[model samples]
Target: MSATDLSASPSAPARSRTVVASLRLLRSELRIIAGRRRNQAGILVLASVPVLIAVALKFSQPREGRGPDFISSATSNGIFVSLTALSIEIALFLPLAVAALAGDTIAGEANIGTLRYLLTVPVDRTRLLAVKFVSLVLGACFGVLVVAVTGVIVGGALFGLGPTTLLSGSQIGLADALARLALAVLYLSAGLAGLAAIGLFISTLTEQPIGAMIAITVVSTAMWILDGIPQLEWLQPWLLVHYWTAFSDAFRDPIFYEQMRQGLLVALGYVVVFVSLAWARFTQKDITS
Candidate 1:
């Protein structure tokens, strides 16, 4: 991103207001996202989960668990540690972290009485919304990357960076394994992207960031609950979380794309719908703050 236009540019040229100003706004949004103490703590917590998982499995024998079979293979190949940590954290921590940041995107500014001033600038509400959503998406990806990186480091020390055993019992070199792990991270981040969009829409509806965060969390939890209900089997296919666990399919030798494709489509659907709704609401909203 280009350097932020530090000086207020209420009268900046329309040429600069094109992509350059948008980039500057995006840069500032990212900086604000990274600089918040709460965001810092949330990221630290995300990094800790993988470390804790790797460290726990190191001292103790692998135990059969309800999660992905990767948990047992952590001792066999450290790469599995990242997969296991991701599978576990994606259930709660990742979503919560995303919710917190997404909830803060617009509501936080409004709560702080800066939103009105922001609108006073040359930037349009649409551009501001776009930048906020992008920052939130990047933040989601960063949260996932932190867990994967932390798991790789700790797991590598505890176990050799050996071949990754696929679900089919075939093995691939460490490099190939890392690539698959990166795919898993990207897939998971895409799933969280939908949640972030939901939070963005909710954030536009409230000044209380906490309320928006809680609403986003509840929406996620409800979808999971609906997915788990056997009576809702027909409905599960449309749920945002239904294919989240499909990242495990990436570990298969042939690499299944059916569920992954469906997951991405679901995420895209949610993002489009909710982001549109947010734009509609925000553009018409009166910003007193």
Candidate 2:
């Protein structure tokens, strides 16, 4: 081949590398999801748990005793209750799932002695980590969306969806009510992103996926324990778990702007810190499996 033609061919490959690498990673992740039956089942169960609880509670109690309107209770005076049911479980469950997935993402490859082969395929470490993180967050978001959508549908179907009278005895229309429910899900996603990052970070720290998953679960539950103790109320403002139920405030009359803002900041801060640490740790660590 002519020198000019050879140089042009080299440039062509370089230009296609990023797209090719991303597609390869995406396909690999899809394959993993398809092959791991236990994990797949776990994901379905996690997504459905909230809806199941809502359904059972709807049947178990009298309409009036079940508290005020489900939407208003979740968004306003019931912020804590709604959060306890939805957001808290997400904060705990999602990280555990991510840790289970990510802890094995690299180490599993190493254990199989496939990491070296994958590394030689021309994907940079940064790109690989970024793709993995993005995939994890996306999966988690999907899972949380499943919970939110199911809860709303089941809750509304059973309890009836219309203007819910708030604790203040004021009424909110169905349109505004649905809008607030949607916003609460969005807010919950932010928290889940932080959790996914933490899981990935823990995953990078160990070769045992179960260990990583357990660590994430334990940390989340511990925060919740702290949140429950009245003496540690000051710590609530700083704890990641504290904001797990914070999304419920969106349905309130005036809206719990301060709580919502605090949740956003805390969640985003956790995401930044966890991802930064994962990058630093994963990049420098020796890969022995």
Candidate 2 stretches with Cα past 4 Å from truth are 1-24, 27-31, 61-88, 166-169
Candidate achieving the largest lDDT: 1
What is the C-alpha lDDT profile of model 1 across 1-289, one tens digit per residue?
3345645454566657577878988898898888989999999998898788888888886567655578788888888888888888888899999899987888989999889888988568998999999899999999999999888988998987888888899989988889888999999999999999999999999999999999999999899889889998999999999999998888898899999999999999999999999999999999977
State the number of backbone clashes in model 1: 0
Single out the weakest 10-residue window by summed lDDT for candidate 2.
Answer: 75-84
Find the candidate with the highest TM-score and give its number: 1
Could you tell me how far off, in angstroms, the CA of residue 149 lies in candidate 2 after the best superposition?
1.3
**Backbone clash tally (model 2):** 2
| C-alpha local distance difference test of each model | 0.89, 0.69
Backbone clashes for every candidate come to: 0, 2
lDDT of 2: 0.69
